[model samples]
Target: MTPPPPPNLLHDAFSADFEHELRFTRSVLDSSNPLLEDLLGWDEQGPRPGLIAVVDSGLHDATPGLSKAIEARFADPALPELRETIIVPGGETAKNDSNVVESVLSAIDLNRIDRRSLVAVFGGGAVIDAVGFAASTAHRGVRLVRFASTVLAQLDAAIGVKNGINRFGKKNFVGCFDVPVAVICDEAMLETLSDRDWRSGYSEAVKIACLKDAPFFDLIEKNADRIRERDIDASRPVIHRCAELHLHHITRGGDPFERAEARPLDFGHWAAHRLESITDFETTHGEAVSIGIALDTMYSHLAGRIERSQADRVVEVLRRLGLPVHHSALHGEAILNGIEEFREHLGGRLTITLLDDIGRPVDAHEVDPEVIARAADLLA
Candidate 1:
């Protein structure tokens, strides 16, 4: 009888649904606009949702009245009650340190922000990623609203369904996949960005265009100068299109949470992540991505996966956009180590995205280190 009991087996399976919305608007914190009220669903029944906002320290310094604006925006009875506003370090510095994440978590706890409450993160991609990590972990889960303040955040990082921070000298080593309650891209906030920061963001747009839309690539190529010069009119359409494409990939690409092995959207990210770490994040992510894209494009050419003309075109576009196609840090063991790190992150075989032509992406299970070395040399 004991032997028969040992033969018994149990199995179970379940599925959960996820749905969230994103908004592209201007001046989300402006008192006159009802975007915040609409996003929090204040018109509906229940108690007003508690809110805790975390602002980027750099941004706070740039915009002195930001706290007042935040207060005024939530002052309306129809909006969620503003509980506490915490300030955090901006840029990669925010992600490299664990204490940044802890501070946000501590703020969430001290504010008594529950799963029903909202954690509004206002800053560039790094700040959003760090704060989103905290919100996702606190109370097992908490809704996050991203007020994307930079071009990079609006078009790429804030639109992402995943959130993360770097650890162990690795990029995005600590993180989780959790969609935010909503993402708000405030176009007005982009005005205060430095020219360097403005140029830094378009690399992501180039990445998406290279992977999914040839026509979009042409548009970016055409407007590269205006965008680099802070021409908002030229930049706005590019931002909208890039954000749209990113959202489409997340919602329709059937791999929003990256359960699949191949990541088409990460066309140039393998070396990009490595470049950032090796440089101690002196190079911005978008800048590293630009160089990564150039490296991979040249690799694709050298490996006979794509025509050299196409690869040249990619490099040219990045250059025309005021983005770096090469960096001194690319020549190193650390950059090559990224392939294994990428494979570990993918959680199976090594799958990387390459291109046969603009907008035509293919997956490769293995890459030649010799070819990678040659490509880096060429970029150098």
Candidate 2:
């Protein structure tokens, strides 16, 4: 494998910084197999070095196929030892599934593997999140790679090195930052997604557009039909673009590893995270986030924090994406209680990303309870 063009010269320079000393890359799964070569810096050396572990939710066939693909690529007997490969299953349930993480870690032996070994997470956001958190904690740290199979994973969860697992009924209550050595985005993997999964993932893509780029929002509007139909050709660019947007916000400024000064871009996450915990992991993260975005926008409008038009627009886009915009399943009281829980989860003082206008965010330190009540009323 030829050495990856010097890190500083890559097209996505921002990614270089996100990975720290680690490397990052994205490619269509069925396309060329340069990722292994690039990652290992192996030319004619036969097999690349590294213990590869593949984590999948087992809900889809893509995960096993991904592992097979990696194995096939490095099958040459003359190459360096490819080390052992472990496959673990569990999806959203795995986010809080410590047993699965422990199983993966035990297979790799935390004390045995070093930075040279690689933990390749090849599944949806939940699987990636679980394995990533495990890898970050194992042996202090090790090389990590993510092959985000779901749209939500690719667009939002997988890029950031924020590895975490749920605990005490709270989402991401345990975790650390362990950026992947590289990322392989196989758009083909998306074909295996259920319609519900697709819609859930698209909700996140919509959030990114609503918070950062109007043109991106417009693109989604225009291609909504094709995207919903699962048009790989049309959806690939959209997925890549959304991931780029997330990467931009995460590495914008300040320390990438530390969670400090919540940006307005984290708009709905405050409620979204809590809702997930309250629902006992029943609600999809994207579904919770969709409701959170709508509720947050409603709060912004009722508080005179943003225009009613802006709130309506947010609802429109979310509805168009086939996402839930109402908190009807959750009572106003529950939502309020959830808000308090969310704040406590964040150690008090909720940080919300409110829109001054569409695509414009302002960090709000203290959110009024009255505003939350009004927002809940609107959703109800």
Candidate 3:
């Protein structure tokens, strides 16, 4: 018997005056050869486009050869002239730190950047978010590309065009919608990740599965360990499948720009942002998201939106992955206050993604404050 072909991946391209393209490919950067020639529509006959590759500083020492490879590949006179490569540290601290922004701005002057030039962000989710935010704001708007180097970045952050920066101790408080020209996902980079980093990204994979694909959820539960171990062969299909699910919802024309209304796509992010803001970004994004998912699940139960067993199941999966599903470190009152703050932050219009049934999401705009309080009690 032959194995079945992998599911056909689907992505909805949002039609705008600006072009946004998302692609997932293998071996993004190969042997000092820039893939941009084929990936970004470069030909020797045409004028060379300016390019900047932003990498994480943490990988500077570990992957010294990567930067040199990028420089050499882009330096080819036959191809586009690589303007300069900026390397910034990866992680929550790096995203919140303003110094990285300063360094990035210095490397590529906003006045010099235009639609012809491209900004390639090569790091984890935080790095991509920071770079995307910078590129969007630079000169009003410039073309951006994501060479996602981590699992989380490749599957989630790299696909979305939302760019944002932390402000006043808040997560992604300031930002805009500037989708990238393309996103390249290279599985090769996963080999160097530590176990913790691998698991951190796994939370996002699980989140996608829970929100959209129930079959994908089953796949994740069964292959959790293989993925955490960075088994690329076993994990590639899973990553591709999850990306498709996200693309399906995003392209459905349900406010991808996030201007008019909030949608179910932000299922667990409401509480997640508050946690990161309050903790001063001490918590990993994925870890904080796990906690947020649990809190929301509890709230769903209290609101009579979902069954108690469904809530418990969500908590169980998070726990098995070694993610924090409860806020034991913080008091109940603090958690309740955080939720209230979250509500206020959104202008009191709580757009929550609740389970009408497992694998089915119902968007609720007005959730009772009493229900939120009762949910906090359960966590307490």
Backbone Cα, N, C clashes tallied per candidate? 0, 6, 1
- The superposed Cα distance between candidate 3 and the true structure at residue 286, in angstroms, equals 0.5
Cα lDDT tens digits, model 1, 1-380, are 45555546877898678776778787777767778767786644787778999999878888989999988888777877899998999999888889999999998898888888899999999999999999999998898999999999999999999899999999999999999989899888998988788899999999999999999999998998898888999999999999999999998888888998898888899999988888889899999999999998998889788798888889998998899999887777778898999999989899999988899888999898889889988877
Model 2, which residues run further than 4 Å from truth?
1-32, 43-48, 59-67, 77-80, 110-112, 344-348
Off by over 4 Å in 3: 1-19, 31-35, 43-46, 337-348, 366-380
Q: Which pairs in model 3 have colliding backbones? A: 57-88
User: Would you give me the overall lDDT of model 2?
Assistant: 0.70
Q: What is the per-residue lDDT of model 2 for residues 244-263, given as tens digits with 9 covering 90 to 100?
A: 87776666645566456464
Reference-based lDDT, residue 60, model 3: 56
Q: List the residue pairs that clash in candidate 1.
A: none
Query: Which residue pairs come into collision in candidate 2?
Result: 1-42, 1-43, 46-79, 47-79, 47-80, 264-353
Question: How many clashing residue pairs, candidate 3?
Answer: 1
- The C-alpha TM-scores of every prediction are 0.96, 0.85, 0.86
Q: Give model 2's clash tally.
A: 6
The residue-level lDDT of candidate 1 at 161 comes to 91
Model 1 score (lDDT): 0.89
lDDT of each: 0.89, 0.70, 0.72
| Model 2 CA lDDT for position 48 | 45
